[model samples]
Every structure is written in structure tokens, then in C-alpha cells.
Target chain A: MPETNKKVLILSVNDEDKDIVFRPADTLLGVLRGKLGLTGAKPGCLNGDCGACTVLVDGIPMKSCIMLAIEAEGHKVTTIEGLINTKTQASFIKHFAFQCGYCTPGFIMVCHSLAEKQPHADKAVIKEWMQSNICRCTSYQEIEEAVASILAEE
Target chain B: MIPVDFDYYKPESIEEAARLHEQLDRQKMLPLYYSGGTEIITLLRLDLIQTKAVIDIKAIHECREHILGEDYLVLGSSLTLTQIEERNAFPLLTSVSKEIADHTARNKITLGGNICGEIFYREAVLPLLLTDSLFVIGGPQGVKILPAHEAFQQTMQLGRGEFLIQTLTRKDFLGMPYMSVKIRQQWETGYPLVTIAALKAKGEIRAAFSGLCSFPFRSKRMEDELNRKDGTLDVRMDRALRHIPAPVLNDIEGSAEYRLFVLKNTLTDILTVWEVEQNA
Candidate 1:
């Protein structure tokens, strides 16, 4: 039997910070949703296309599904569930940015990443950066407006 | 969905990685080396590639250095586009890399990964071609310096076992107004219809077009036309437009005629911008 062991740091919205040993076969998304039970980072396209499984690895936005768990051993990981702040939550509700709400978490995660990095980004730059994430509900206008408003406040 | 089960090894040193590859040498254990899993993960999901052992080269420190010399800029294999953009050492290359996708994808995707993957319209390759870059490849035959165009052509023929250690580009070709245009439905999907990259040095102009051909190609006919003694672009522009290949790439997003039309229009627009800048 072949064995490979690697340490991984799993950060979730849940109160516990779990440090687990993983096999190289396990992906970062697998560890987050399967082992840790934090499914906010939805698994829409596991091949890094849908942007559903987006997360922040060491303060940088990344598609967790394509990343190996072992590669994120010592890095700080932040997920959508972890981004629920009072200000952000208030802005999300005021704008009514979500329709079906299935894509809300991904959008929020991306927004959080952007806001943290470039809080003063203009409307056009935000739209350009958010182009990587697709919203099937066609509710991008409101979402973009809401994000712009939030950035304006900052 | 998780990828197929495979033994994983993280090698901290290049010698260890080379030794492991030598040991596994075409055995039943199919080995695929990965720096960042952006493209490889998709290949795994589609079963386009199957591997028994996966070598993670992220931990190799030697493959992660970016050395800027007086004459050339050498970027290690593990250096991500985000890192390059942050440095802003190569302005033209940085512009092309930023336009590849959003910052998220740029953070994980590495220079060597895209080069070794050999996908059409790989953003890094375009700037590298424009700058006449060279690739330092580490293979069973030992380390060798390969011209960027030749390396890309050879990689398309042979599978990516030979590791591309670093990319080298001439540093003196800086401060030139460089532009790259990519036509796509969305910012981050399939290949572009046509991409035009141009560089202006003094009175001489160098430009190349890709995404319409089987591979990224230089428009020698177009360059020759620009070199005429008349200094008037009217006839040269006509000749250049005539030399553009017909029946442009008919892919999932666009028609062949549409691509060709866009290609010609884009070339004209870029040349016009260059002419205006030169006059100014």
C-alpha cells in the first residue's frame, strides 16, 4: 500500500479551526465541503471554471477545487462563509443582489476578495474583475451597482 | 469531483525531482508534474490525461526565483503571473498577463505551467514571442536553452516531460508602446478570435498576430511592407491586409469569416494607433 500524508489548515465560518492530515488525492474543495461540512463554497464546476468554489488563499483569490490540499498546508484560507460581516451583509440585503441565491455565496466571496484588496475600485474595474465569475440569473446589474455603492462608501 | 487516485510527491530540490523522473522513466506509473493545477486539473477531469504519480513542484525553491539582469530577465518556472504583475518589471508582458483573466486565475497560474501546457493563445507566449524569449529546459538530455518559438512547437509534438525551468527575455526592449488585443465573448473563456501585439522602436515597427493561425506567428510580409522607403502607410497597409490568411479560425465562439474580418480590422486599428504615436 502506498501512503502520502500532508498537513492542511482548514479555516471555516464554524468556530473551530481544524488542522487535518490529508492524502495527496484530496482537493482543497473536497476537504472544505466533505470533511469540514462547510458547503458555502459550492462545487459548481470542479475544474476552476464556474468560480463557485472560490476562496482566499493567503489573501489572494483562488479556485479551491483545482488546488491540492497539500499545497495549502501553511497558507491562510478564507471561504465565503467566513466573509459574513455586518457591513457586507447589510450591503448585500440593501441592494437585493441575489435572485435565486445559489450564486450569491460565490459572488459575495469574490466581492469580499475585491473589497479587501481594492476597496476604491471604480465601477468599470469591478465589472472587469468580476467577469471571471458567471451569474446565470442575469442579476449582475444590481450586484455591480451594490458593489459600486459599497466601494463608494469606503 | 475529486481527481483519480495518484501517488503525490513534493520535491524541494531540482536534483531530487530530476532523479525521481529518471527513476520513474516511462514505467507503468504515469507521472505528470504540476506547478499550479489550473489547466492540469481540467485535463484530469476530462480524462484527457491519466497519471499514476503526480509530482508537485511548488516546493522547489530553485524553480521559483526571478532574476533580472542587465541584458535579460529570467523568470523561474514557479513564478506566478500575479508576482510578475506586482513587480511590473516587464510592462508589456504585465499588460498581456493582466488581460489573460481576472486576478484570481493569475495568482495561481505559473509562467512555466502555461508554457509547458502548450495551449493556443497562451498570453505569456505572445509577449515572449514579441520579445524573442528563450526557455531553459531541464530534461534527461540535460539543461538546454531553446528559443521560445522552437520550444512551443516541440512541446506541441512531444508530451511535457521535460521541465521548463525558466524563461529569458531581452531586457533592453523596454519603454516601447506595446498593445495586445484579444477578442472574445467573455473576458475569461476559450481562445481569442485574433490577438495583435505590436512594439514600436524608434522609426522601426515590429508587430505580430496570433489566434488566427495554428500557432502564434510573425507577419513577415506585413513587417516588410512597413519597412518601405516611401514612409507612407497607405500602400503598405493594403499589402499587409492582402497578406492576412483567409478563412480565419472557425472555433466554438466565432465564424471563420468573422474572425478574418476582425483580424484585419484589429491590425488596422493597432497600426493607426502606432502611426499616431510616432507622429506625436
Candidate 2:
């Protein structure tokens, strides 16, 4: 059944459906960081150019800042908080993937998505997939190493 | 940056969606039909475009389905670039899209949005123009199908209450040897300075280029010159390109001279390769 409403109910972390009332302009990033208190997904660029607001929507990594909160109806939304205990998180430290740590959450979510799709993504694949994320810290090589190490472990 | 306030509608069927659009247009509501919403949201936030309402077309199951027919490949317009790339539906599409944006953005950038988008370098559509493709459009007049080249002309030229539904490709296109070369001044995600796509089938060549004009286009004069095969491959290739109308595209990323240089040398190489393969 199709829906016709401004408010959308999304199955958020832990498969809990939450009612999110948003202005037509409210982005998923705003809702996640403001209303839901799921601040794991940082806000930056506001446009799709930056990946700081990336999240998993229905298992697909999408730019939350460019996604309308009202558009996520009936879809599953996962933030960096959902990845706390995951191996990708542990591997981040193991591979020394973070510098200054501002972009770690975004990279974690992307790595989680990549690991789910291709558990053994090589360094080339990791570099290819991570182009969406922009880290001013210039820690990309280490980030790629971290992500590839996790994928290689599988 | 927050977006301007607007209404959102998700209709169940194509007819219902079209009707809603008609009703909205009649009221001068300035409705916009969107599927992936990636470009829509960004443009809205950046104040690049505005609308009073956004109709969610993803609710229609038809827009999400991709069907591989016996003689044709039917790709729902709303299919994301990442989805098509992952499925390897078409080699040209996969190669072009795999490098577009990033992992997450790809999930939200649909085929129709890329083809009909405002910014150029829409390399995905470059290959489609060379092949026998068609656009299935849904509007107030119900469903209508138009050839790919004609549809490309009418795309974004669509009237107030219309949307692209799907794309139809002849299966024989799969047998055509295709090439897509993009010269980007920046990193992987950087916009291409020049995009060239060509298809060789039945001893004929069809080529389309972008980032070289106000919009992407194909050059029949160039194609005819190359197909004539009157002289040496290298000279004919250069002469054919010289026939392209100017001013060829010159943007911040590249100057017109540089675009022509890259296009001439790269296209010549591609044509040379094709000539060798054909003669062999």
C-alpha cells in the first residue's frame, strides 16, 4: 500500500518503528541528529557532495543530508550507533584508519555497507567505494587500509 | 542547509500520479515528480531549483522493476545507477555509472535523473544515444514510447504533468562493440571534462559526446565522415572531428582547445582500434 502523508514512520535502529514528523524540507540528517538524538551521523556539506551524513537506508548506504526524512517511510534506517559492536568498528582502530576522528563514523557506515555487500573487497574496491566520503584530514590511505583489512579478514 | 517547505505526495499508480500532477498543475502548485530524490534534495537545499510539491514516484512498483526481454532490455527509469551497475545490465552503463558519485550517492541517483539532470557530463546517456533505445513516458495522455534520440530531445522538455517511466533497448545492442572514455581533471568522483561514447555495429560507427557543448549531443557529420572510410583512418578521424560545430564546450574544468585536443586524439585512437578490429 502506498502512503500519502508528510509524516513518515521508519523502522530505525533495533527495528523500532518511530514516527518522524518533518517539514518537507527536513533532511534525514536533521531528523537523525536533532529529533531522534541519533547524533552518530554528523552533518556537513548539507548537499550530496560530502559523505559526513551517510547512513544505511533499507541496507543501502545513502546520503542522509540529501534524503528527506519524510521520504524514508517504511524503510529501515541505520546510523553509526548501530555499528558500535561490529567488527568494522574494531577494525577501524586495528588498521589505524582514523585521524582527528571526525570522519570515522561516516567511514564506518560505508565500510559496514561494503562489507555486507562484498565481504572481501580489495584495496582497489575500497578506494573506489569510499570516493563519496571527503575527509579534510587527508587520512584516506589509512582509511582504505583499515577498510581493506577488515574485508580481507573475511 | 535546510530546504524550503513543500508538500510531498506518493501516488500508488502511474495514472493516479499523472492525475495528481494534472490537478496540481491546474492549481499552479509547481509540482515536481522525483524518484531517488538525491539530486532533487540537493538542488532544493542549494536553492538551485524550487517547487511547491514533490511527488514520490518510487511508490509505484513499475518504476523499480528491470526486465530483460528476449530481444530487448527494459530498464525502469527509476533504477539507481548502482543497481544497474551491480546487475551489469549493460556494460556501457555499468562502466559509466560505477564511477559516478560515491557508493551511497549512487544508491539515490536514478537513471532518469542522471539523463535528465541539469548538470552536464551525463555520460550514462552518451552510450544510450548511440544504441537503439527508447523512452517510455507516462503523462496526462497515458503512456507513450519514443525513440531514444527523439526522447532525449524531449526530455526535460516534458510538459507539466509528465514523467519518464522506463527505457527500452534492443538486445542486438548487446552485440555491438561499445567504448566510453571520460577525461576527468580531478579525482575519481570529479566531473569529466570530456566524455565520448561510440558504438560499432554492422560496419557502421555511431558516436556521442558531452562536456563539449551546451548539452550532450551526437555528431552525424563526424560519423558519416568516418563511415565513408575514403582515406587513412588517422586523417579521416581528425577531419571528421573538425566538422563538429563550435563553440565546443569550454567550462572551468577545461578550455575548448583542451577539450578538442583530448577528443580528437582519444577518438582517433578509438576509431583506429575499431578500424583494426574491423579489417581483421
Estimate TM-scores for all models.
0.88, 0.95
> Model 1 - which docking category?
acceptable
Best by TM-score: 2
lDDT of 2 by residue, B1-280 (tens): 5547777788879999999898878878788888888778878877889788788888787788788889888888789998898888688778767767776788899988888777666667876778868888899999998887887851345765889888888888866788888788777676777778888878898888877776777778989988885788777877787777657777788888888888888888888898788779
True contacts kept of each: 0.54, 0.72
- Top model by lDDT, which number? 2
Clashing pairs in 2: B212-B249
lDDT per residue for candidate 1 within A36-130, as digits (tens), equals 77788888867666677787787677888888776776677877777666455567779998888776777777777778788988766687667
Fraction of real interface contacts that model 2 preserves: 0.72
- The candidate 1 chain B region of ten consecutive residues with least summed lDDT is B152-161
Off by over 4 Å in 2: A1-11
Go through the candidates in order and give each one's DockQ. Answer: 0.48, 0.63
lDDT for model 1, please. 0.72
lDDT of each: 0.72, 0.80
